[model samples]
Target: MLVAAAVCPCPPLLVPAVAAGAASELADARTACSDALAVLAASRPDRLVVIGPAEEGARGVHPAGAAGSFAGFGVDLTVRLGSGPGGERALPASLAVGAWLLDHTDWADAPIEGLGVGTELQPARCAEAGREIGASAERVALLVMGDGSACRTVKAPGYLDERAEGFDAAVGHALGTADPAALLALDPELAQALQAAGRAPWQVLAGAAEGTGLEGRLLYEDAPYGVGYFVAAWS
Candidate 1:
């Protein structure tokens, strides 16, 4: 069996909207996550894991309650990081979305696991985990959440400056700003590097709200600040 995992960064504010926006733009993200999960589940792999930040803070990580599950989607169980705070045990928004997907799908009754540890969201650690999980499964897909900057920070070998530039450009276009050139003036070196990486800024920007099919303006208008960097990848 092949197992696939997708990771996405999520802020705390969107938690309430999972059920509230069952039919809105937020549903786009939900569908994307569920699609990935369904793919993994269909592969019938040994395990399918989804990684993300803690919802409340960045101290620890944990899984969501049983109320969350994705039925027909390809998830047998969900393992979440514990709370990042002192002693609070809460899952991150990314993982919460995963759990919620599982709950909403046919696999709602599937077993969900929680893995809590005090660790930083570094690339080495995440990659290491990805490798470990991959080793055990016949086939693996990893969807990393977050944009170039966030992914670069966590994934190590930081993203090339070119990628960052592309992201900035996309952001500028999405924002309808006439002078994204100012970004170049502010961070010339970074801009040059992003340009060199050959990264697709528009793709990174689009990925955030890819499944939603909503225009960038509408999604960005409602998304919380700093949420744009959240990304997902499969390996």
Candidate 2:
């Protein structure tokens, strides 16, 4: 069962070094993420699992001490998932972003693990993975990282799509209310069409929280850089 869960966007821009001049624009997002992590700590969970969308066929389980670096994004900054047995396995971008969040929050109470789910994964499989995660440890907590839609504005990465706004709205509502059914019911086809990276991982969250009755609060929602980023907490 999930004792607590924090949902965050996995943008490289979340890191000040990576964002550079644009860093100030995401100040509120940073604060919201910090507050969400604080909420996770308050739950006193013994373990935390970080889930994020990854490349096609790149389903990897990263250990707590797995390293992550932003050099590929033009930054040399590096972060660790937690304190597992140190290894050379570098985390994928999504898991790297999640690792960066854990490091930034100075998480220490529990060991942290990361799961990278392929973006195109079927909802059923994603949910099953989530169920496994929730059952991995007693008093487990989760940090789900993925972006909403990337086609909100005309300048958006995927270009403006008329359906983007409505899609993001429903996602926002579902996440804010901790509606598992809504999340589970999210259409993968529509999400892919809208370039919503959060679909699969959010389904994983839905699986973990099914029947848990967790109350949710939307911490933040914005479209900085034309991509929908959201932060929420379920407890």
Candidate 3:
């Protein structure tokens, strides 16, 4: 099974300014989150699920052991969108990388899950947690990070209800069909404050999914500031 889904709206503010020194903005968000986690550990996926949006109803899955050596890429699930205690914080860096993978790995004995977050955009808890981990998995890849009004307010309202001009073709067909890469590590004064708060929909869904097959790439590196990385592969 190979799955890598990453979405970011904040929380990699250069890893809390490199643990709070702000050395040149933590060396440009640690060189763009180490080149997007070295292209997500070069597509070596065993299990790494991280969904977004959380403020109070914090939900976190287990197994966070070897994130360094990539020991089986453990860290099953953690989906806490919003709506219970508080909401609207969208993707706070996916809850600061799910609280830095539950305070630096070990998954807390693994196996912890929950889902809610509903009010406007209803992905129904991210498509029922992506079809319950894609029905026992063999291949699953979904890296979604807020934009386009946090993915058209979280989709699922019978697909395309929010209708922000078809929110990037409805979030590239509900974050599937693979082939999406949009990296813009803002720094030019936060990319002119996100183009004066236009909130570029990841460059308009990577230029309308280009050739139409839905493979897109846009990396404007100023260095990984507010962190964004999505790598998925399943076999």
Candidate 4:
């Protein structure tokens, strides 16, 4: 069962190296993420599983030391999922960002592992995967990585969508309240249309937290660079 959880966005912009001039814009989000992780560590879970979005065929376990680099995004920064020796497989962007967060925070809470869930993954499958993770260890915690809608403004990456604001608001409510029903009820089709990368992973979180009675707290919420980013903690 899940003893704690930290939710954060997966944008490469979270990395100072990748964001460069725009890095300061996300300073608050970074702080919130750090605070959330601190709560997770305080829970003293025996295991941590990082869940994030990936390509359709990229769904699988990313063991400790899985390689991650921002070279594709024009940066030389590299990170590993854990302290293990490097692996040949390069993590997908979302997991890469998750790894970067761990490296940036110098996480030593618990042994860490990663799982990539496809963007269009069915809710049932995502829940099943989550159940497995929740059962994998005695006191499991999650570091869920993925971004909210990217259509918050006309200048957003996906451009303006009239429904974007409402979509993000509902998501924010679900997360801030730790409403598993609301999370599981999120419409996949609508999420895909709005370019919400967090849909699948968020559902996984819902599955893990179901019946666990973990209270949630919203630490930060913003749409910097036109992409909805959030940081929250549950324990």
Evaluated at residue 193, the lDDT of candidate 2 is: 91
TM-score of each: 0.45, 0.96, 0.24, 0.96
Scored against the true structure, residue 77 in model 1 reaches a CA lDDT of 35
User: lDDT tens string, model 4, 143-188?
Assistant: 9998999999999999999888898999899999998889989899
Clashes counted in candidate 2 amount to 2
Q: Mark the 10 consecutive residues where model 1 has the least summed lDDT.
A: 196-205
Residue pairs clashing in model 2 are 64-82, 65-84
lDDT of 3 by residue, 1-235 (tens): 3233333333343244324555464454334334433343454444344444433433333222212111122323333321133333333334444444334322312232222122122223333344555344453332333333222223422222233333333333433343433222212233222221112323322222233343322322221222222222211
Q: Model 2 scores what on Cα lDDT?
A: 0.88
What's the lDDT for all of these models? 0.35, 0.88, 0.32, 0.88
lDDT of 2 by residue, 1-235 (tens): 7989999998998888999999999989989999898888888898898889887544678877888889999998888888878465678788888877777785656988888888888889888988888887788899999999999999999999988988899999999999989998889999999899999999999999987899999999999878899999999
Per-candidate alpha-carbon RMSD to the true structure = 12.5, 1.2, 18.1, 1.2
> Higher-lDDT candidate among 1 and 4?
4
